[model samples]
Target chain A: MKELEDRIRRDGTIKPGNVLKVDAFLNHQCDVALFDAMGAHWAQLFAGRQIDKILTIEASGIGIACVAARHFGNVPVVFAKKTQSINLDGDQYVSSIYSFTKQREYPVIVAKRFLQAGEHVLLIDDFLAKGNALHGLIDICKHAGVIVEGIGIAIEKGFQEGGSKLRKEGYDVKSLAIVEKMDADTGNIEFATTD
Target chain B: MKELEDRIRRDGTIKPGNVLKVDAFLNHQCDVALFDAMGAHWAQLFAGRQIDKILTIEASGIGIACVAARHFGNVPVVFAKKTQSINLDGDQYVSSIYSFTKQREYPVIVAKRFLQAGEHVLLIDDFLAKGNALHGLIDICKHAGVIVEGIGIAIEKGFQEGGSKLRKEGYDVKSLAIVEKMDADTGNIEFATTD
Candidate 1:
């Protein structure tokens, strides 16, 4: 967690629309070493929780989820698809997610065969702003009758209500870095904790 | 490689359009353990190649690329984006790829900053059929002035011309499993080699 927070402080940039750009290492160009470390940290934090599967959204979350799955005893990772493909057919657990960045609502779906009933799942993602995506994942898990053991996030926007809202709901949400404040004009960023 | 081929023989379903569905382990529901093994095998195959990066496309390729990066000495994995997002801005290396399965042509873009000139990149993907996506990636790498040390594929449709074409063009293409033939009616799949 310290390493992640440190990386965020070093490489992350603040921009307009309350965006923290980390494409240099987090999203587009991924550091698998960092992801491995983060995965080990998450595995330790959620030890003995019986996480049967790791769930994430497409494109961005796939790398982190896969790397994290290594630390979770090589559990299978099932990513929710934001777009429908010909390969995806039959029964599905679908949920609508509102994107704060894209300013649009899209559907996220997972094959019902992947998330079985009574399985314990861990939700992982890159960022949590308004908890819309996380909430959508939770809804999908609920619909599939799977128990969400916890949520792991690389970075959370502390200025936003997502993290707090999930915490209030008593979800075991662990975020490596929380951006408490950001000054776009000055390019100054602050983390929630010094550690 | 044997493990991968065995898993494919067990779980892979042959369908119309030359589709060998390994979604249970390779794509939708990913087994990171198997990916780790495949990564290790790829690392050995491409040993001493001095690969600085692992290049892949979004969604399916991200997991394999991330897992494989660990074996490639924890190199950075950069996945090209199929769809543009608000976060993606500035100069980009773009290519047009035709998907035989989807029966459409779409654009794949990689941020210019990620793929540096003279960097050694290894392209990794889930499948190779018509070489459209692989060619697009090679084109992107060519535009960026990077050396593609080799290409790693989980499965290659040997019946198709993609893998053979790349080999003929002098690329170090290594596929874990190559399906020489598939009978959709009988659901029989055959790999090209015992090696």
Candidate 2:
């Protein structure tokens, strides 16, 4: 966790409108080694919990979740597709979410056969800001009749309501790096102290 | 390679219109253990090549490329974005491609900073049908002035022109399982014999 926090401090850029650009290492260009370490940290935090599958959204979360799946005993990682494709046929659990980054609302889809009833799932994502994406994934899990074991986030914006709201709703959320405050003009950032 | 061929024969489904769906383990719901094996196989095939980065497209390719990066000494995996986002700012290498699955023309974008001139890159993808997506990635690599050491593909539809075309272009292509023929009605699949 400290390694991730440090890496974010050194490489991450604070942009206008609270936009933290970590594309250099986090999302667009991925650091698989760091992802593996984050996965190990989550495995420790969620120890003793039954995680049958790792669920994530497509594009960004796919890489991190797949790399982390190794640490989770190579569980199947089901990435919810953001758009409907001809390949995506048959019954599916669908949930819609608005992405501020993409500036549009899109449907998150997962094939129904992949998620069975009573299966324990761990949700993983790159960032947790407004929590809309996480909420959409949670909605699909509910419809699929699966049990949510825990949520693993790479970075959480502490100033935002997403992380706190999820925690208050009785979700076990473990975010490796939480940005408490960030300055666009001075390019300064602060992280929440976690034990 | 035999292991991958065996898995595809076991879990891969053949749909109408020449659609071979391996979503059960390969793309939609990923089997990371199997992916690890595929990665090891590619590492063996593309061994001795100087690969500084792993380049791939978003959604499906990210997981395979990220997991495979470990076999390449944990190289950085850079996935080209399929859509424009507010997070994607500054200079970029852009190419357009038409997706048969999505039934639309989309832009393949890679940030200019991640790719450096003369850097050796290995292109990885989940499926190589018509090679439209792979071509887009290769176009960006060309514009960025990166050297493509090799191309690693999980599955290639040998009946399609993509794999053959890329091979004809003098690329070192290593496909784990090459589907020579498939029957949708009978659900029978055959792989091209390889040495």
Candidate 3:
């Protein structure tokens, strides 16, 4: 967590509309070594817990989820596809979520067979903004009658209220880095106190 | 590769229209343990190569790429974005690729900063049908003036021209499992002889 917070401080660029561009090591260009470390930290945080499956959205979340799965005893990582292809068969649990970055509402679905009833699911993602994607994954878990173990996030936009709202809702949400405030003009970022 | 071939034979499903659905382990519901094995195999195959970065497309390709990065000494994994995001800035290398699965053509963009000139890149992906995605990635590397060390694929539809064509073109394309033939009605799959 210290490494991640430090890396974000060094590489993260504060842009207009509260955009923290940490693509150098977070999203587009991934630092798998850092991800492995983060995964180990998450495993430590969620130690002694039951995690049957790790669920995340497509694209950005898949890399982190895969590395995290390795830490979780190599559990299967099930990513909810953003689009339904003809190749995807069987019943599906779909939820419509608005993407703050893409600025569109799209359906995220997981095959019914993957998220079985009574399974403990751990939701993971790269960044948590308005919480639409996280809630969508949670909705799918609820529909499948799976138990929500907790949520693990690489970075959380603390000013956005998504992480706080989830905590208020009584979900155990763990964030590696929380951006408390950003100064776009000065290119400065302040993270929440870990202690 | 024997472990991968055996897993494919056991868990892979053959659908109509020559579709071999290995989504249970390869894509949607990913088996990270199997991926770890595949990553180790790829590391062994591409051993003693100059690989500075591991490149792949979004969604399905990210997991394998991340795991493969671990085997490649935890190299950075840069995934080309399927969409040009507002957060992505500066110069970009874009390529329009046709997807046989979705039956559409779309642009894939990689930020210019990630793929540097003189850097050696290794392209990794889930499936290779027409090689559109792989070519697009290769094009991005060429545009960035990087050296493509090799290509690693988890599964190749050998019956299709993608794998053979790339091999003919003098690219080091290593496929863990190549489906030479598939009987959709009988659910039988024949793999090409590795030796």
- Which RMSD values do the candidates have, in order? 1.4, 0.8, 1.0
Q: Give the range where candidate 1 chain A is weakest over 10 consecutive residues by summed lDDT.
A: A186-195
Question: Residue A153's C-alpha lDDT in candidate 2?
Answer: 96
TM-score, cand. 1: 0.97
Superposed on the true chain A, the predicted chain A of model 2 yields a TM-score of 0.99
Give the DockQ (C-alpha) for candidate 3: 0.86
**Looking at model 2 chain B, which ten-residue stretch has the lowest summed lDDT?**
B186-195
Q: Give the clashing pairs for model 1.
A: none
On a 0 to 1 DockQ scale, where is model 1? Answer: 0.78
Query: CA lDDT of B71 in candidate 1?
Result: 88
Q: What 10-residue stretch in candidate 1 chain B is worst by lDDT? A: B186-195
What tens digits encode model 2's per-residue C-alpha lDDT throughout B69-124? 99999999999999999899999999999999999999999999999999999999
**How many backbone collisions does model 3 have?**
0
TM-score of chain A of each: 0.96, 0.99, 0.98
TM-scores, all models, native as reference: 0.97, 0.99, 0.98
In model 2, the Cα lDDT at residue A172 comes to: 97
True contacts kept of 2: 0.99
